[model samples]
Target: MASIELKNVIKRYGKGKTANQVIHGVNAHIADGEFIVIVGPSGCGKSTLLRMVAGLEEITEGDICIGGRVVNQLEPAERDIAMVFQNYALYPHMSVFDNMAYGLKIAKVPVDDIKSRVDKAAKILELGPYLQRKPRELSGGQRQRVAMGRAIVRQPQVFLFDEPLSNLDAKLRAQTRLEIQKLHRELGITSLFVTHDQVEAMTLAQRMIVMNGGVMEQFGTPEEVYTRPATTFVASFIGSPPMNLLKDAPDAKPGVITGIRPEHLDITPSGWALQVEAVEMLGAERLVYGRWAHSATDQLVIIRTEEAHAVPVLGTTIHVTPRADRLHAFDAATGKRMMTA
Candidate 1:
């Protein structure tokens, strides 16, 4: 396993005046064997950044280093990295064992060594029993495992995943995620996974880079990004139901944006008066959607409550207080986090 580093990485298309920059000055030092996830919405350049690191896209400027060697000009084959793409681009006629061993065979590895590597990868991915099966006979998750095993047999310094789980059903995705986690623990190869799903990022990442419009919005562990987001975009994007950003909060400081998570707001006898707008009964909890009482903006606020608690009546004014310790404040102009004084 080797560490990966991105030093002021930038990517653009076209030349001169018409050059449209997509990745803007991204920089990060990934520790040896660290699992990093690049996460963002669709069209946010996450895939573009990953492709640049894989040597698939030429970077406009800056350097990409794998194992301390700058590889900006290297071909993808020279980068010592393996990639598992969203599509399982397997040769349908070939069996799983042959698919996994194809790369080694191309490199002219000995017949016995090819079998050794394929066997090792297949065992780890639990594809041993189906090693002789063709792609058409296996399930989607099994096919994806074959794709991953193909990468694993290469035994490269780094592994790059481009939304490898996006094609699976919810249950299969969850199962594959566990398998990937186990694979990492067993092999401990440095990995950079790209996905648009935040839950996947939060679950699989040791550290995560949150991107927006090709810019790095935040880079930290899942807890850090979820609890202390560096920017308003992060504040609203990282959480389920997301942290509420209120510009016209009651008793709000002028020009300061107030941020609070739904669970951090509690029903109180007196505080911010909110009129209940809607209620959603989730399996184990209830979500109460309310609007600022008699306000011009009619800002919607969500409060999360336990299933045991009484559901507030729709249209009734309820007072909810944001916990003091949980309140987050940000700058309205720049959308950046405001350090607590």
Candidate 2:
């Protein structure tokens, strides 16, 4: 395991008039044996930053260090890092055992050592039963395990996973997530995972970095990012159905933006009023969508409820109130969060 450090890293394309900067100066220090996930929407430079650390992309400025050694100019193969790509990148012709042993073979490791390493990885990944099968014969989750096993065999200082579970079905994705978590606990290897799925990031990462517009918005543990986001963007982007952002109209708060998570709000008798626009029945939970009832506002707020009884009809008035202590305020212009009562 090795600690990874990014010091004011930047990635740029072209020069002069046509210069396009993808990653602005990003600085982060990942502790040894830590699991960190880089998460953001498409085109937010999460993958670009990962590629730069993997030595697949050039660093236009600053430095990248692994285990206290500068590796800005090193080749991807020479960096001593293993990466599991989004597509699995397995050889179609090779059996699971062969696929896992390929990297060791290329490195000219002893034949006995190769067998032991591959066997151990296969055992850990629960792929021993399918070691003789080719990539085509494996399920998506199994194939993903093979890809991970390939990385495990290398025992590199760093493990890089670029949305490895995105291709799997929902159930498979959930199962694989648990497997990965268990694997991380057992190995305790330093891993950097990149994903667009916030749920994956939240569940898998010990510490997560939220990015937007090619900049690091917030870097913290999953709880901190979810509970007390540093910015409105982080709060809004990290939640399911997203944080309800409403303008604290002149009669309400004085902040540029007021936020209330769907779970933090409730239907109240003496509070704000809303006109129901839509209600979605989602098994155990229902999503109530409506807007504030002070004449008109274009934005809508969502409230989550577990009961289906007495569902509000559309266009009907409903009284809604949020816990004052649970409300979040943010700068209207910059979108940065403000902590207050």
Clashes of 1: 0
Off by over 4 Å in 2: 249-255
TM-score of each: 0.98, 0.97
Find the 10 residues in a row with the least total lDDT in model 1.
291-300
Query: What tens digits encode model 1's per-residue C-alpha lDDT throughout 1-341?
Result: 89999999999999899999999999999999999999999988999999999999999999999999999989999999999999999999999999999989999999999999999998899899999899999999999999999999999999999999999999999999999999999999999999999999999999999999999999999999999999999999898889989997767778789899999999999988899989999989999999885565778998999998888999999998899889898999999999632
Best by TM-score: 1
Q: What ranges in model 1 sit over 4 Å off?
A: none
- For each candidate in the order shown, give its overall lDDT on alpha carbons: 0.93, 0.91
